[model samples]
Target: MRTPLTAGALLALALAAQPALAKGPATSPNEAATARHYASLIAGSQPNMAELTLFFTQMPKGGDLHHHYSGAIYVEQYVDFVDRQGYCVNKQTYRIETDKALVAAERAKPAAERNCLSSAEIYADDHTWRELLQRWSNKDFFNHGALQPPPDRLFFQTFGYFGPVSNSNFKEGLQELKKRAIAENVSYIETMFKLSPAVANPDFDAKAWQNANDDAAFDAQMRAWFAVLDKDPAFNKTIADFVARIVDSSEGIDDERFTMRYQTYVLRLLNPSLVFSSMVSGFKAAKSSDKIVGVNIVGQESTNISMRDYALHMKMFRFLKSVYPDVKVALHAGELAMGDVPPEGLKFHIDQALTVAGANRIGHGLDLAHETNATGIMQTMREKDIPVEINLTSNAFINGVEGSHHPINLYRKYGVPYVISTDDAGVTRHTLSNEYVLFASRYKPSYAEMKKTSYNSIRYAFLPVAEKQRLTRQLDQRFADFEAKIARLAKTAAKAP
Candidate 1:
């Protein structure tokens, strides 16, 4: 989340941390004095702006658990890939237009008339491209803008714009994303993506739900959907081929780690039967394959379909949990703010997500105060050890929730495990490191605390226990190496003067 404290408030906080600033010092007097004097100016007793930024850039963020595989990748890569494919970026909205005929037309035009002239040209006119990017995603490139939609709308729309190109080449996309993750010092990512292409059509999906009250009818419809999957061997083949590609490409990378887990996500705003059937299919798939780890209900939870069927979805998961007990779940719950929906609507999302859906993890539990008996909810999560995946940029962009209004500090205060994530990094124009920077600078998390967040991802991941243990050890070694590098850099920087 962006800083909610005003400049004056931040200045005051910085000035007030004088005594605490006196404690820790570098070995060298010059560095120690510089650090001490700078500490006096931090509200959270964080490092100075320059050093803090360097820390952020160098921080070894362990994994990106809440990332969207396609959206987690950098946009510059997409541009280059499509340029080679001879695809044209739509002139009006800048969406990637991959039509072969349109590509031909775009090629016919002079390079200047092409939708994407060049990266340098785009950066040269940063103001114009930034405006377009804001429309595409919820980026705070230009703070003073009346033209951009609300943060939530802009952030969500980015997916729609990038979806076409993203879906076209999953293997290439995953490979490129893994490469960047390696560069950014990230290991392991539990990314969200639709699995098996078995999503119910909206029309049939609605009719299926009309009979949801009748268990037999609902069961019949589920059978029909499964039959559709059975009939379409191509769908299964697609998944098999995709998984093969991922395994082949991610063979022996040393710098970073990669593990793929599919979230058989259903559109929450869909009909109840559709959502229930999807969950059933998701479980059925995960039970059959190791690659598809869990099920998730996504999209705006504030919508009518989502709010009305919230309890129903949870009950479905509960029922499925009995059968496919091993199939993991990480739900999107408590994503709404107080004013985004009705007062009553906010009262029970987190509770239902935990008690009803039996979610092992939750994405964006931002509206903690909105739940009924939030204290009990917090207690339940603590006892259950269900971690809340906090996507700072997404929360700030989508719900306008930040700073004191956010429950990050509160979760810490309550001992509820929480890990920071980039819910949709591409949509937010950020990397995992950027999210860490915001937290480190604003929250002043101690080195141990930051490392704890990395450990949390493994604890909550759907990987097998043995794999998790091995990864945990690897992560500890990586953390040590990272700190050594940082310490070495500090020494070198000290020597330069």
Candidate 2:
């Protein structure tokens, strides 16, 4: 009998035989070699997490598609802003205090009783510094035994603490994000930067609430409101100013090696008129500037207002798309888990986002299996070529969804396109590289699949065709260099004693 092939030999044959296993074209020799080494790192039952982290840290991630602007700024950086603005932090509450009267009153108290501390004082007090880190981010939340709120609540609440200063240092914040993205080999970013301006019309809200469930009536009503908004000077000026802010804040952020785009979002936790009006402004903002590539809706999806207005919000997107057909949308649908909302609430988010909103992409599609006609939804996504942004860390921290429980495996099994992204890297206190590490170790996808996912970030990005092509070409070189480096590392390891 012929001698049986060694496990290593079997892996080699498998890699050679299926060099083009993923959706794209055949891999280059360097990619194939990298695949072999990658398999070696993550092959066994307990994969090498350390090596996997290093591998993905050096890997080329094409883009971060579902990024949030304010949430992507670290708390430490926000503290710097606090210092620059001469603001004080409430030591007891761990919140930034800007009220001069309150600061003066707190300063009048004895040192031990004082509640407001300056940034310098906060740093000097090590306990307050550590507490601020924990409160501002996911740091030490899981590892320690402290009285804490639910993960999802804590995740959303961080915004309240940092909101006052989030928009103040716009250009500086963009520079910080660019520096971090380059260090991790991320070629592009599509961030949901800020909320568009909103105006309340009680007359409009009453009519909208009455017609919320009727698509035809709602569409007609929305058209009339759009005409009114078109003539409203204040509304138009707000849209213009919103576009100007984006253009001004994003100066000097793009280069040959990196690209960044903004998406103006509407918060869902607002009155009907405010939400719909903001949606209109968001689309107009996208139309006004090439740098503003798309519009998005963002908030805690399971909030009382958000859940009640979920379908209405999707309809809002649908109607706006009719008006601004060229503008793109990427809805944060199906972000809720089982207990976060009632069972029926989970049934139609992803479906409505696709079938109604006509979203180009879906973010945090965690409720895929729970949706109505789940299989059909996946089929529609596959046929329509819409990709889902999978945020493994965000999902785990916010919704406790990870490991085999994540729907990513389902997306893969059904051939629905998906992209790995860092939803809010700064708030979660992780990197795109760490997100990749989680994906690789948990799923054990082939090197080609991982590479395809990287390309998918660029492919599914809301950029003009020429920009997408330019980024695609840059990504090609990035991966080529990255794979060659891995291959060299593999060869060097082989030759080592």
Best by TM-score: 2
RMSD, one per candidate, in order? 7.5, 6.8
Task: Itemize residue pairs with steric clashes in candidate 2.
Answer: none
lDDT of 1 by residue, 1-497 (tens): 11234546544544443333234435454434433332433445444676665665665677777877666755666655656666656656677676788667766789667774333444556664665566556556457546666666666677776666666566677767777777787777777766333444675557555865675675565556656754576656654564555445445433436555556666777666456656655676677667667878787888777777776677677777876798899989899997999898888888878877789998888888777657666666766788899988888878889877988876676567888888877767778888887776777765546666777877788888987887788887776666666656666766895
* lDDT tens digits by residue: candidate 2, 129-176: 989988899889978877889899899999999888897889999999
**Candidate 2 Cα deviation (angstroms), residue 233:** 1.1
Q: How far is 492's C-alpha from truth in model 1 (Å)?
A: 6.5
Best by lDDT: 2
Candidate 2 positional error at 256, Å: 1.4
